[model samples]
Target: MSRSTCVPTSEPALVVAVDGPSGSGKSSVSRAVARRFGLRYLDTGAMYRALTWWCLEQGVDLTDPAAVVDAMDAMPLEMGTDPAAPSVRVGSVDVGQAIRQTRVSEQVSAVATNLQVRARMRDLQRRLIHEASEGIVAEGRDITTVVAPDADVRVLLTATELTRLQRRALELHGHAEESAVAATRDQVVRRDRDDSTVSQFVTAADGVRTIDSSSMTFEQVVDALTELVGSRTGRVPRAGSA
Candidate 1:
């Protein structure tokens, strides 16, 4: 993992919102940015995935929007904000890892696309952001536009389809070979298509910065975002420190 040598500056009230499609590196980059800036972190997609996991565990009909919304209302979710060890828990079960399984990934879009569910989640997300008094780096599909449109720093991190596909493949599988990319297409491409119906993450919203990471290394992307934050908040990192 690449890391910046610049020491982190304390910015307790700086909220950074990052939005992107699947495999765009929003989660990793946002978490790293949060760590770099001493901010809390929230992965909004994991919230939807946890809901999907709960519905599946409870045998609720994901096809029924009302049931999904009801599930959302009764969900006892605990989201950890620490970027170093973020967790997702539903009730007493620790599902931080289970939510990332293929099962949840396949059904998450169905739960996420529900208009009622999104409305409820928007409220819950706002509350969570408010509670993170020290600041937060919230990343999700609609975060930059819907969830936190007025965050201190809003970013839309994107990359070419091929780049996204390859990255996701490497993360899911162990490599980015053609076979792995082929196996990972549905998870990366189809999910983005379904989720895009409710959020505008493909393009940068007004006053939102867009970081194209197609040719940039992970550290480079993080460095760019760090620099952007510095430019916006006047906490610039030392030149050539990384």
Candidate 2:
């Protein structure tokens, strides 16, 4: 198969931006790509999850957009940008595990959909992307179009609906049975519908390369992105095939 090339750049730092729907393998692919390129990794979803955790802890109503935005405005969130050791700490609580709970999964969209919250997140994300001294791999719903459109490499990683549902079921339930998939439908499908309202990830933006990973293994996806990057950087080093 022919490979796509990233735009050539001399900017001191190379930013690789990837956007995709949930369960499309973008997170795993982006992390693997970051490991390969030795770039800092940023998981933008974790930020919203942490905020959701915060709102629930503070007893803020999810229906009140103004309250949500105010809490997020003062939210003391420290997001670790290293993909190798990605961490999320809300105040004194290390919520890396807490934020991934089903509770946060169900309610995060309420906070993420707040236009003010998104604006604040966009500012923070841009600053984080710029601060990655040795380049970074940032992935989320809007990184390619909204957050880092000028990234050295912008990719839209995607997978089919059935494939995405099955993958998410496996991740959440350790099995991809019908029961598991049914349980995961709302988390993956409903959230995607709600997130699409504020950010576009279901389709690639103009000039953004789209990698459909429906039939690709995790390693294959990583390798494809690496090749895409290498094409621009010229004879780039592989990220170690361990």
Candidate 3:
């Protein structure tokens, strides 16, 4: 594994980067890890969803990279850390509910695929991490590879396609019909392809751990990650220090 960029400390905050495909349990695992250590948690995917909602509202062309970049720069983003009820804000407006709509979900990947948009978002992500005095557990597709490659602990979660699909379906429930689920599946597959083709998607690092969650309960995954963090730090994480 590549040398970790994480600086050691006597009472250091745990910086965890959790990466995985959609419905692979990144959110749940990341939240649990943060709660276990009392660290703040970030759902990076919400950033993209917020951006997508803004672009649609402004009628920006998703296919136009330059336009999307302009919108990204102009939009204001506010992220919250309350695990029980996290939120995202754009400008003076709160679009938390709007960003999760079926329309936004369908279009977010297109906007996310824009290289310039990703660059801008990456900058924002880095800023959030740097500003965190107490450490953070950030979960997203690119965190382990691009956003926080040098994080003290990098974990990649994976599960079978059927398991992922079922989990996603349950999340959608009445909001998405069969066609929407199919479209989401297609979008996920394409995103996977794009991420794999992107040179920076996965960093070759010695300490990066990959876990298959097909048969593991959420608690089991959390316990495993807790051990990884404990081994690296040589001590149990301090309360609220994840």
Q: If scored against the real structure, what TM-score would every candidate get?
A: 0.92, 0.93, 0.85
Model 3 worst lDDT run, 10 consecutive residues: 197-206
Query: Could you give candidate 3's per-residue lDDT for residues 72-188 as a string of tens digits?
Result: 888988998665566799978878788878888778887778888888888989888777767888988888878988898898887877667666766776434666567568556
Q: How well does model 3 score by local distance difference test?
A: 0.78
The positional error of residue 20 in candidate 2, measured at the CA in angstroms, is 0.3
Q: Which ten residues in a row have the lowest lDDT in candidate 1?
A: 233-242
Best by TM-score: 2
Per-residue CA lDDT of model 1 for 1-242, tens digit only, reads 99869988755577889999889899999988888877789999999999999999989999999999888888999999999899999889999999999999989999999999999999999899989887889999998889899898999999999999999999999899999999999998999999889889998989999999999999999999998998888765444444
Per-residue alpha-carbon lDDT of model 2 for 104-154, expressed as tens digits? 999999988999999999999999999999899999999999999998899
Quote model 3's TM-score. Answer: 0.85
Taken over the whole model, the C-alpha lDDT of each candidate is: 0.91, 0.90, 0.78
In order of listing, the candidates' clash counts read 1, 1, 6
Rank ordering of all candidates by lDDT, starting from the highest: 1, 2, 3
In model 1, where do residues sit more than 4 Å from their true spots?
Answer: 1-12, 236-242
C-alpha RMSD by candidate, in order: 7.7, 6.9, 6.3
Candidate 2: give its CA RMSD in angstroms.
6.9
